[model samples]
Target: MEFALAALFELFESLDQCAPGSRAATLQALQACEGLAPGARIVDFGCGPGPATVALAQAGYAVTAVDRHGPFIETVRRRAAAAGVGDRVTAIVGDMRAPDFADGAFDAVWSEGAAYSVGVPAALAAWRRLLAPAGWLVLSELCWREGARSAEAAAFWQREYPDMGDVTQLEARCAAAGYAVRGGFWLPADAWAAYYGPLEAAVPAVRARHPQAEAQAALDDIGREIALWRRFGGEFGYRFVVAQRG
Candidate 1:
């Protein structure tokens, strides 16, 4: 498990994005967050490499980007500096599940493609205290689309994310967790490609570097995930859900 995790981390270390997302998608979700004036306090939980963090900072939000990985946090700092938003971004290496922040510290809590690390319902419930009254929570989550799912896709997710649910289920979770569902939209296919394209391209080099059995297994898992997406993408996708604290 350690070897596989090391291989996975090394494989993702060089990528500009660690998840399926795009700048346009981030901006679209931000637009749904009404009443957030310029420089509103926002904490980006599980901010992998800080792509969304930089985007929020560029949009004039004072963002505190937190991720468990130290290197990724450093990358966030450098990226923010390069983008001229270093002063606006506070990059911290910390766990999103227990950020240890003051209550009501932020106007918004934003996470893209990372909430599933802690189940969505748990994340929604735990992060609620971090937001001021009526604050917003915007996150993108992997969800089964509302239609026939291929057997291969079903099996893959069952083995991977057995707790995964459809959009309506996610919305119900939001309401049950004390948020009002504002709106949501499915992430476009291009967003997946944006992440997987580079990931697929780098597989050979990563495989060459990690020749151990466990490392190879990790690489194989990544390949299988990409192949499944290519073949059965229509059945499942990431949904960007926008909700506000009640």
Candidate 2:
């Protein structure tokens, strides 16, 4: 697990950047929860490398970052410590699908391009339970127009995620889970470029540095995904804003 994560971090040179505004956008969307005090509780649900986790910590929030991958969790922990927020952020190795977080323990829950990793319904239902009353949950997920299911879109999302749906459907899931529809939008693909462009730059450096490494293969795969991301799934790529636990 550690080796896999290490490779991921090494190979995906710009993964942090490719992750939708270095997750600053996600943080901004979730700031609605700021109605809480500065030292409020925040959960970076499925936090890959602690972007939002560290940001929350820096903002004086007590943060808990959870990821199923052992190496990823380790990386989050190390980064938190290195970034001077180790004491403020508690790193937990766990799954986001059905996270083991205690009920209503958080002021906000942040999930960027991860809820779909777990089925949206399950992710929606599960994350809701972790929020304190009035807690906000911010998610940037794959969304498409309701009218069309092109063979291309279907094929792409099926391979990537069989359960993904349009933004409206996702919003319904949130309502079913007791969350209010606070805000939602069709996120522009430019965000993907922000994350991918930096990564694209890093690829050459990695290839040059590790000419014979497996990172090359991972880089190729990421490159392929990025190049085709919008083509196959552009209609559905979206971001959502919600609050719940009422």
lDDT of 2 by residue, 1-246 (tens): 443345566754335532664445655665655486678888887788777788778878899988886666787788889989899999998878877768888888888777767777788878887888788877777776667667766776677677767667777888888888777655566776777777777777666665444556665666776766756654556665555555
Task: List runs of model 2 lying over 4 Å from the truth.
Answer: 1-14, 145-151, 188-190, 202-221, 230-234
Clashing residue pairs in candidate 1 are none
Cα error, candidate 1, residue 212 (Å): 0.1
Worst 10 residues of 1 by lDDT: 2-11
What TM-score would candidate 2 get against the native? Answer: 0.79
After superposing candidate 1 on the true structure, give the runs of residues whose Cα lies further than 4 Å from its correct spot.
none
Please give, for residues 97-212, the per-residue lDDT of candidate 1 as tens digits: 88789999999999999999998878888899999999999999999997899889999999999999999899999999999989999999999999999999988898898899
